[model samples]
Target: MTNISRSNYDPEVEESEYDRLERRWTEQLSELRVTQAGTQIMMGFLLTLSFQPSFETISLFERNLYLSLVITATLATVLAIAPVSFHRILFGHPGAKARVVSITQVLLRLTLILVALVLSGTVALIFNMVLGTTAGIIGGICAVVTITTIWIALPMTVLRKLR
Candidate 1:
C-alpha cells in the first residue's frame, strides 16, 4: 500500500464530506491489519486449548476461567477481523467506507476489552494450576496491571501528551 503523505492532504480542497471520511477510514483499515493478524493468532491458540490433556486436570474455577478466556478471544478475533470482512463486502459500494470504519472503531474498542479479559484469565489459570488460588490472585493482579500499563495508561499518557 502506498503511504498517504501530508502533501496528499489539502484542507482547502473541497470534496464531499462522505468521500473525505471514506478516504480517512480506508487509511485506518490499512493501519489495523497488523493488529488483526496478531489477535487472530492468539485467538487460534486459545480455541485449541480445550483439546489438551491438561485442560481436563484443571479445577472447576480454572476451567471456567479458560472458557471465559476462550469466549473473550473469540469475540476479540471477530472484532479485530470485522474491518477486513466489511471492506471486502462493501468494496466499490457508495457510502460503505464510512460505515465500515465506524463499525470497526466500535469493534476495535470491544476487542481491547476482550483481549484484556483473555490475558487476565490466562494468567490466573496458569497460576491457579501451578500454585492454587493465592498465586492465581497475585497473577491476576499482575496481568491486570500489565494490561493497564501497556494498553491503557501508556497510550492515554502518550495521546494526551501528543495533544
Candidate 2:
C-alpha cells in the first residue's frame, strides 16, 4: 500500500462511517458537476454537425463514426448523471451513501471510457471531413493517446509514486 493520507485530514478527529460517507459523497458530487459540464458541451457541439451541409457528403464509414460518437456521447452524459439519479432514489435509506458512491464510481469509470471514445470519434470525423481519411485516422489516434496519457496514466503514475 502507498500509505497515503489526506493532507487536511486529522487522525485525531473521530468520525462515524456515515460522516465519512457523507463527506465523500459531497466531494464526488462536486466532481460530477465539473464532468457533467464538459460532457454537455461536447454533446452540444456534436449535435450541430448533423445539420451541416457537408454532413451528407461523408462516406459510410464517416457517417457510422459520427453516429457512434453521438451514441457514445449521449451514453456518457447519462452515465455521468446516473449517480445523482441513484442518490435521489436511494436517499435516506440505510447505507444509501455507500451504495450511491460505489455505484457511481463504476458508472463514472464507464462514462470516462465512453467520453474518451466520443472525443476520439469527433476528432476523426472532423479531420476526415476537412483533410482526408488518413488525416482523420491520425487525429483519432492522437486524441486517444492524449486522453489516455493525461486521464489514466498520469494519475496512475502519481498514485504509484505516492504509494
Q: Residue 45 CA error for candidate 2 (Å)?
A: 1.0
Task: Assess the local accuracy of residue 21 in candidate 1 as a C-alpha lDDT between 0 and 100.
Answer: 80
Q: Per-residue lDDT tens digits of candidate 1, residues 32-63?
A: 78667767887787778788888787788887
What value does the lDDT take at residue 58 in candidate 2? Answer: 85
The runs of at least 3 residues in candidate 1 whose Cα sits more than 4 Å from the true structure, single-residue gaps closed, are 1-23
- Residue 112 CA error for candidate 1 (Å)? 1.4
Model 2, 1-163: lDDT tens per residue?
Answer: 1355677455335668778777778878887898798789899999998998978888999889888888889999999999989999998898788999889889888988888999998998889988999999999999999999999999999989867
Which lDDT value does model 1 have at 148?
A: 90
Worst 10 residues of 2 by lDDT: 1-10
Which clashing pairs does model 2 show?
A: 2-163
List the candidates' TM-scores in order: 0.78, 0.90
- Score candidate 1 by TM-score against the native: 0.78
Rate residue 50 of model 1 by lDDT: 82
Q: After superposition, how far is residue 72 of candidate 2 from its true place, in Å?
A: 0.4
